[model samples]
Target: MTPPDQPPPLEPAELSAYFALIEVSSLLRHTIEQQLREAGDLSYVQFQLLATLGDAADGSRRMTELADGVVYSRSGLTYQVGLLEQAGLVARAPSAEDDRGVTVTVTEAGRDVLARVFPGHIEVLRELFLEPLSGADVRTLDRVLGVVRDHMRAVPPRSARSRRKGAARRRPAVDDA
Candidate 1:
């Protein structure tokens, strides 16, 4: 750990503030997760994955890209894709330009599922969160979160050594297979 006197290291309070922000976000996220899980039979991570694909131009995203953006490994995502495939919610197809890279596309059944649940989900958010916020509050949140998102994306992914070190400390038994 870097010493407090070092100019490069952020202060303890700064680190605490960062943690508090994460906690606050997690608390809010839990509410959405619970609602989605109970009401729609979807995990928060699954919902994110589905929504990301559903929003794509062709409703298809490459496996590696999807893995990076969502809370799943390439293999774990492949498993989820297989499950979704069995459920008739999505289909996998080889990329035309590169046979080595496959893409998962939402099926018509997936669209039907999304259509059934999306409106209700939006309503839940409106009731639980959005409706209470003033217009100014909404705009301010949009601006601030946009800046934070941009800044966070600016940081490059960690090197393998750093990633392994952090993952080890967290004790996350990630099933890469």
Candidate 2:
């Protein structure tokens, strides 16, 4: 019997959708970051951290809570928060019960910065992303994106098996042992 025909090795041209998605995302983030920097001197992540905390009740969110709300990991949040705190864009305070934990709060200056830039920000959203699509198109796009995200998350991610011998729970915690 003859061997079955082999598939070609994956290339950038073969990953058109995936490559386009990543490139577009990078460009969008860079553009937004530039606009933010020009208007209020905030990086994309910093602006998002502030916005996330600002949306939380009492204008504060615990470190873990904040991390889960956004894409950053706990350590990533830590690094970003340190920078924002230094710039006085965000304030870090001890959580009520967890002395080991911190709560992030957006400052008045932060809010002022947001207010100054938000109008232009909305305009950018309108002109670049939103206004180009009809309302129905926007809704459909959101639904499709949601479906794609759900599918991606539902699929188990591949990783090398760890040495720890236990049934994995929700999140993998580092073993200090």
Give each model a TM-score: 0.73, 0.74
CA shift of 62, model 1, Å: 1.0
lDDT (10s digit) by residue, model 2, range 47-159: 88888877777888888776655655667778989998888878888899788888889998878888887887787777767877899999998998899877644522212
Candidate 2 versus truth, CA RMSD in Å, comes to 5.9
RMSD of each: 5.2, 5.9
Please report how far candidate 2 places residue 8 from its true position, in Å: 12
Pairs in clash, predicted candidate 2: none
Worst 10 residues of 1 by lDDT: 168-177
Q: Relative to the true structure, how large is the alpha-carbon lDDT of every model?
A: 0.73, 0.74
